[model samples]
Target: MKIKQGILFLITKSEVGGAQKYVREQIAICSKEFEVYLSTNEPGWLTEHVAGEIAGQLLDKRIESRTSIGYLTRLAKYIKEHGIGLVVTNSANAGMYGRIAAKMAGAASIYVSHGWSSVYNGGKLAFLLNRIERYLARLGDKVICVSAGDYEVARDKVGIAEDKLVLLKNCIFPVNATAAADRPAANGRLKLLSVARFAHPKRMDLLVAAMKGVTDAELYLVGGGKGEEEIRSYVHAQQLDNVHLLGEIKSFNGFGDYDAFVLISESEGLPMSGLEAMSAGMPLILSNVGGCKEIVVNESLLVNNTVEDIQRAIRALQHNYVQYKMPVKSFFDINFNLLVNQDKYLGLYRSLIK
Candidate 1:
């Protein structure tokens, strides 16, 4: 497929998360098929992790009235100057500026909502976010939701047209299958996995609280984030020796260093990590929310956000690990693998440029 115009990928931050993962994978795949340009707040951690080479620019701007407009003008100018034909924005913040700038520059724009901001925020904040998304929806030529639930919110709550909203579930390039030792732990301890940025929605505290009295259970918290201090402080305060703050270790494949995988996020757009863990053959104890719920076919693994429910779910997995492993792998191979879904994304880009 010969491509005429460069694809500009605009995102708010370079932080490590599901949205960042999507950006990395998208660029890795798209760069092979087209010219990929990235614009973000800083050359974040993802700068080092992508699969292929990309041209990136730093466009830092506060989410304010005057400052945002200045950034928008600069972005529009950049798009026109670079001859960028398709502008795709990730996350809500970038969606705001990128969509409007793409409109001003006469470039086709697609806003990829990792998840609705309104779904995660509360009270007055949620109300404001709903209005912001509704406004951004008009500026974007197409709105891509990373999950079906997110797609529903884009149509029902954000008021994006059903025709304009597209559900492009997150996918990752398949990894070589690693042979992990059977059973969670030989020392009689249950190794639990939690891979997420230690951020607000991650709810690491809830995970720790659930671990309070669970016997022979050790929780390994992975990834770094702004919420690191809060999570560390809580773990220290509780004197929870069973919980090990592994920081960000690249070594632990969800199955090898852990017995079971778990993520109790408040909201998500079909998290790629859960899929990654499943590909590694780890049993899951997921929150009954968003993509995780959809990944785990068995309702037995899904639990509410309460500590008791999490504890109950974890205990159930610990007792019946083998029963859940098959379904987890089945879900990942069938839904989240990029090999099967890459053409759909490529065709979307091709259609836009055509």
Candidate 2:
């Protein structure tokens, strides 16, 4: 006899980011136990990547960040017709619509918050969404946070119940890293790689500024977002040729040629790229914000998210990198192992619907 399995996942953007990959990896893991479905808008990286893997559906009617009334009805109808027992949402926008639709369809809802949208610096719309997100926290049967920091913020500031919030930290497995040409051990020029969206709070401009003084270092900024042009203009204006924007690269673990990985985002929820870098045996220089702090425990590698501080950290790290190398990767193994995390998530999935 075949056991029943019905789980649907909802995400807003299909671009390849930590949140998208988080949803992808979870769906991949959960598919082993149940039938999986994905509902996203448009044709994007996520749509192309997950094609034919499971049942695919598209949410056509939508606003800039929130689902529309028509889309919500369609989603609920899809859920009811498919007999979906669980509806899990990743990213803030997805949670908003997915939870409501799940309720209409009589299914359990789970919201995986990458980070609270309100924490970062954004204009008016972001502020409004941040305000509304707190109310939605109570809609989910469980609100899964990717970092302890996010979990705390949701519970303390967002007014989510202590019992409803769960800390399910992100994990990495090094076994699947791509093979990039290793940098020469001599290392006269330190090459740094940062994989993050070019958003306002990402602070790539600070990284470029830090490079101006560090004559012995170069940086490759990967990923894309609305702020890409401004960063490029700043880099060009500063004449910082040492800084290169690789745009959005398809491969996440392709940092084989760099000396270290860096992320200076104003906010995060335990970035997947940072953990992947650690799993790939790369050291990190990160801002001590959100999940980045949770990923790297050692305080030395953490910067104050400023130009002068980052510059000093870069110059200092270039000299004493050998000492900080082992501890970074070791932390990933201890705290973010793949199988260890899989069991934790699997347990949550089983218990939530029951």
> What is candidate 2's lDDT per residue for 184-294, written digit by digit as tens?
246578888999888856888788888888878889999888989998999899888889989987855576767788889778888888887887777778998987877
**lDDT of all predictions, in order shown?**
0.77, 0.78
- Where is model 2 more than 4 Å wrong at Cα? 1-3, 61-67, 121-131, 178-187
The reply for model 1, stretches above 4 Å from the true place, is 55-66, 175-180, 250-255
48-96 per-residue lDDT for model 1 (tens digits): 6652467555456452233476788788888888778899888767888
Clashes of 2: 0
TM-score for each candidate, following the candidate numbering = 0.91, 0.91
